[model samples]
Target chain A: MIRKLCIIGVGLIGGSAARRARRFCEEIVGIDADPENLRRAETLGVIDQGCASLERGVAAADFVLIATPVGAIEPLFRALAPLWRPDCIYTDVGSTKGNVVEAALRVFGIVPPNFIPGHPIAGAERSGVEAADARLFEGKRVILTPLPESAPDALARVEAFWMHLGARVERMDVGHHDEVLAATSHLPHVLAFTLARMLGRKDEQAEIFRYAAGGFRDFTRIASSDPKMWLDICRANRGPLLELLGEYETALREVAGLVRSDDADGLYACFSEARAAREKFLKSTENNHA
Target chain B: MIRKLCIIGVGLIGGSAARRARRFCEEIVGIDADPENLRRAETLGVIDQGCASLERGVAAADFVLIATPVGAIEPLFRALAPLWRPDCIYTDVGSTKGNVVEAALRVFGIVPPNFIPGHPIAGAERSGVEAADARLFEGKRVILTPLPESAPDALARVEAFWMHLGARVERMDVGHHDEVLAATSHLPHVLAFTLARMLGRKDEQAEIFRYAAGGFRDFTRIASSDPKMWLDICRANRGPLLELLGEYETALREVAGLVRSDDADGLYACFSEARAAREKFLKSTENNHA
Candidate 1:
């Protein structure tokens, strides 16, 4: 059992983690740059106590889970390196794993044995502590990318920690995790944001928006997600994200070319192939769930 | 009340229209080239009687609503023109208004005064008559793009017909309707289809799809739409679709450059603008309904 847990950035991811881990941990302390979030987390009983300073927050923490934005991870890691507790296990819930892993190397001159990089593949557009729910991780996938120097027992403990919180835990190398997530999550988000901007800027914007049905609403739903957090993710996962974005942009340009030349057969083929692929993917996913 | 209404093409959109119009029409006759659709539509009670031939179907109808693929519209309109009934008002539920209007002119040397172009913006990823729901158009917007030759009385009757069936009826010119729909619907659908195909064809497709979560599912929901119908829409609305798709591709490329250059501020601006626009659009849409 965890004696004390420190969850930094007590927003959606952190607060939800605390709420779910509350059962296993004796005490969960929340920390954030924003005092409003800490107050709300306390009011919601998401944390046993709130701390404004990193020192006070980490004072009693036997396990540390840094849940801050991707850009803040390196700075937080740098600060925490000097305050390292040798017996404490360290993990994070950042979207991009490469940056966090690199931060550990930069701070310690070697990857810390206790530092485990984790990313929970679950979130809602409505964020912050008020939107926190204990059941957020229920049936969700949590990926842990452990360092080469990661202690076997510490890795096992983090894996068990997520599993106990009802997450379907999995492990991968840090680079692969970042690449996979860049393709699946980051690229799709950028496309949604671009499409929303396209229609939102028209002269007949009101009419266009008025006629946008369920399909449009669903397609652009992710365009309403937190921009600052998404921006940080894009910057943090630059390499894989740029590669994937270039590939997607090429695909879109080809489609636009087909439409431009009135190539009905070409357009049909692309759309048909896409429909088949989506069907195959969804079918396999549903079967896996079953 | 619509008396002896004849509806051609008993598919999802047509089938749903018939089901909803049942309460407002007397003796609704369903016609389709596919006998299986006719059978299922009959079993589902979406239509009163199934007619195999267009001659037999529109023989006793006071109103004729052509509900076929956009490519099939011209031929259907040509055939109906030769069998024209001056008193029986004619209309069609085609996705592209400009194409349907041009077809009407080509078939009869001029658009018939009885002919009206209408498009109900409601659909599901699932197609076929079996997926028909009476409430598909509940609180949905149905745009009418009537020709200059269209009789005022016929336009009024067509408007009343859809309005009676629980749709919020609106009017626009054929060109504007095509342009608006190209931006709001066709562009987004193409993006979803492209993204789905991109991820599905990747080597780590299984892993990528496994962690797609809510954003990816919602974004790609329209990728599951019937490909043939979507292809027809792309072909019919080529001009506006190509223009919008090109503009969107350019916008996407700019964002991709921002990510590649690690320009967090630029990426943040784009994402923030998109989020604000989506929020504004949804807010106004909800308020309009309220």
Candidate 2:
């Protein structure tokens, strides 16, 4: 029944969602704050129509997807709420759910029972619509955090929407989604960035980079992510992110102790166990479509 | 003047080195502990000839390269000492230089003037001769640690040998080499393995893996590395490895504090700084050519 979709902040996530949703719906419009982004999305045919301003573009769409940085989602939703059709559904493609959900609840006050929160767990080092592809979400897991008071019909429709785009959808409480993602996604990225920063602080940064082999390059590649965007993620998922970081540091210290003591056997055990676990994770995930 | 070369251990590194060294030398023979590996190298035409026995392989060769695991290098070098031609040059391809240097010196009262301790900074997650490619070393850095008493003539010959194989060789003291590599290569691998292990310890590893994005996959890809190989590396470089682990933990703890404090300003500063550093590192290393 949700045939027309308008996607806000048409960057990588928004553009990708628009492209993937094209197969399930007949129409898609994209809006972006940046004129260049709107122009690129239009040329790429990522959307049937594109607008530099959100208000002019998304006023009549059946569904509006807010896919911006963590800090911008609430403001975006509030701006679009006035134009939203009475029965039309609303959703998001944000990395942190709790903050965005709270922001939405604070701004919209339960008038729209059709609002659904979702996150498609798929992305690349690259960003923007220029880097977006329709197949980005195919075989990827998409987590939805619908409020308990959300209309069941609205949740089902949103779930069906993502499923049609080839994403396997799972629903969980928003708080739980924030905690799980904080551990698996946000914390790792923060650690990577921090490690890279420490190395770069040295006067011999050029030497360090020159000497970086495959391992160093891959380990810190995520460190090169967009600054403002990652800042937004860290701030939004602060509580759980801090908890996970403590756990990681504890494990690191334990390994460090074994190394300090010249406990070759202990170091070997830790490395072996870690390597085996990673192999198992990769093998188990191989069957996933994405 | 060095023409005939012999490489022990016909795995990825040995096979690739044989092919690359073949370009500079007229003939190269490879020896492997496993008959299957020797046979595969011969069948792949990676070597002019394959020797099932090391004694027969190094007896006639002017340059011998022990390209085995860190622990295996000492035993192989010791066994070859009896059969070693008086003026023959010897070298090794091990991850840890200090330990290998110590082992070699332990075997020979004085460090062999012709013994070159080297590690080529090139490899992939995949192993075995089948994965070897002739251009593997092209544009990659190769570090060499020559003892203070090492013969200049011997050092020159070894440097020329790797240069001919398309690596840009850099010289560093053994201790510094271990310290730098412990941070650039070893610690990152340890963290990767640990991350994977943490997930494996979880009750729903399958669920965790199902949602793993590209970030986790790439970050932990090296965790799929051979366990015995990593174990040897950890044991051999315990001192520097412990120091690097401590530094990494300290960095992680700082990020955790920012997260726990929910300080958006602090988080942004951290992310922005890291992002700039990573970009700078990448830009500087762009023209490394090795």
Instruction: Give all candidates' CA lDDT scores.
Output: 0.87, 0.81
User: In terms of TM-score, which candidate is strongest?
Assistant: 1
Worst 10 residues of 1 chain B by lDDT: B203-212
lDDT by residue (A90-200, candidate 2, tens digit) is 888889988887787788876357888899998876889988888888889999988877889888888988887789999888887887787678877987888788777
lDDT of 1 by residue, A1-290 (tens): 89999999999999888989988999999899899878989988999999988998898688998899888987898888778887998889999999888888888888788878899999988889888889988888899998768899889989988988888888988889999899878998999998887677883344678888889889989999999999999998999998998899889888888877878889888888888877776775685456
lDDT of 2 by residue, B1-290 (tens): 45788888888898899877776776788888888888899999898899877778887788988888887877887888888776788888888999998887798877788888999988887889998888998888899999988888878888888888888999988998888788778888888877777766762532566667888777788888876788788879988888777777777777777777777788788888888878877876687762
Off by over 4 Å in 1: A203-206, B203-206
lDDT of 2 at A17: 82
| TM-score between candidate 2 and the true structure | 0.92
Q: List the residue pairs that clash in candidate 2.
A: none
Off by over 4 Å in 2: A1-3, A22-27, A39-45, A48-56, A80-84, A109-112, A203-206, B1-3, B23-27, B39-44, B48-53, B203-206
Winner by lDDT: 1
